[model samples]
Target: MLTLTHRDMLTLKHRDMLAFGHRDMLAFGHMAMLTLTHRDMLTLTQRDMLAFGHMAMLTLRHLDMLTLTHRDMLAFGHMDMLTRTGTC
Candidate 1:
């Protein structure tokens, strides 16, 4: 199983720091990290973190069956929606 520690979270300050893996779950972790950033939670609030994390999982889960292009579009579209909604 993949485990993410607090220190792991801290080191993943940028998307470039995310490591791509062979497993789907690990790839999802990369996407989640892209959604969440260090500046996003420098104060490290659990509530905010959970909210974003939940959204990332849900968004990816629903898009899992789609083609990569479609999935990418919708995933990024979700991000755009979140931004416009002031949720990001």
Candidate 2:
């Protein structure tokens, strides 16, 4: 079982934030502020969730997944519909 204290959670968040590029610095500051304010009340699950979301976002950004245009959105929507209908 992995147990994390508030300080550990903050450290992890900061480290992950810094792993990205300069474009994410603003978001890093925002996350740091939010974590500092809510550190005392944060549960391990909540921290894990936040970290997971950040990791996903970072992965998407790194893969240029956030550069989707309107056409890409439409295509993705179509794909989602197909998957939902078990047709893809």
TM-score of each: 0.19, 0.16
Q: Give the runs in model 1 whose Cα sits over 4 Å from its true position.
A: 1-30, 35-41, 53-77, 81-88
- Candidate 1 lDDT trough over 10 residues, lowest sum: 62-71
Best by lDDT: 1
Q: C-alpha displacement of 53 in model 2, angstroms?
A: 7.3
TM-score of 1: 0.19
Give lDDT per model, in order: 0.28, 0.22
Model 2 spans > 4 angstroms off: 1-32, 46-48, 52-88
What value of lDDT does candidate 2 attain over all alpha carbons? Answer: 0.22
Candidate 2 residues 1-88, lDDT tens each? Answer: 2333232233323212222222121122111222322112222211111222121112222212222111111111211221111211
Clashes of 2: 0
